[model samples]
Each structure stands twice: as structure tokens, then as C-alpha cells.
Target: MENLDGNIDLKIKEISQKLKELRLSRGYTSYETFAFENELNRVQYWRIESGQNITLKTLIKVLEIHQISLGEFFKDL
Candidate 1:
């Protein structure tokens, strides 16, 4: 169970890192700017990038904003 928990945590971090990379690739140096431009809650977006818990709906919305499908997002992860 502990190992499973660790794996989950690692995956969360990976997702967070990928989100950050995507933001950077889009030329947004600040998460705040990205969030504001997208009309998302700044704090929530920050938490998502910080590896905090995120809902599937929110994740999907973000991916949509990035023009990336779930398959593409997870392909290299």
C-alpha cells in the first residue's frame, strides 16, 4: 500500500511538471499570467502546478487549453 501511495505521488509530480513544461512551451513565464489569460482561478492553477490534487474535469480543461489530447499528454509520461 505504501508503495502504491508512493507511485501515485510520483505520478502527480510528473503531471505537475508536464503542466509546467507545457506552460513554458506556450511562452508564459508566470503561472499567474497563464491562469489569468485562461480565466482560471489563479490559486487553483498554482496548486495544480504544485502537484496538489486536481480533478479530472480541471485537467481536461487545461489540456484543451493547450490543444493536447489526453493520449498525447500521457504518451511520454
Candidate 2:
């Protein structure tokens, strides 16, 4: 896993915005609901969605829950 050392802050903002939009579009009422539906721990998912610093492994997992493959996740960036 890359340690998320470069552009970490920028990436956080970008990912946070995208996650917020995706959650709203999915009609998810809260982080708990979203996490449950996505098979993630609610607290961990909340942290990621809020752009708090996290491990790359967790980041990849969250992206997967969002149905974003590694390739697709980076193509736009």
C-alpha cells in the first residue's frame, strides 16, 4: 500500500466530496445505513467519508464498497 504521503489532503477533499454525493444519490439516510449496506463498519466508513486520514488498505476497501474498481477510481484523477 502506498502510504498516502503525496497529495493526501487534496485527495481527501476530492474523495470526501465524491463520497458525499454518492451517498446522497443512493438515498442513504446516514453513515450507519451506508456502512451496513456496503458491509463496512459504520465508524470506519464514517471516518473515510469524512476524509480523515486512513490506511491505504482501508481506502481501497471503501472504494470497493462504492463499487469503484482500482482502475476506474484513478482514471479520472
Q: Compared with the true structure, what per-residue lDDT tens digits does model 2 show for residues 1-77? A: 25666577888778777777768777886889888988889888888777887787987877776687877777666
Q: Write the per-residue lDDT of candidate 1 for residues 1-77, one digit (tens) a residue.
A: 99999999999999999999999999999999999999999999999999998999999999999999999999999
Q: Of the candidates shown, which would achieve the greatest TM-score relative to the real structure?
A: 1
lDDT value, candidate 1, whole model: 0.99
Residue 64, candidate 1: Cα error in Å is 0.3
Number of clashing residue pairs, candidate 1: 0
* Candidate 2 clash figure, as a count: 0
Where does candidate 1 have its weakest 10-residue lDDT segment? Answer: 52-61
Instruction: For each candidate in the order shown, give its overall lDDT on alpha carbons.
Output: 0.99, 0.77
User: Ten consecutive residues with minimal summed lDDT in candidate 2?
Assistant: 1-10
Which one wins on lDDT?
Answer: 1
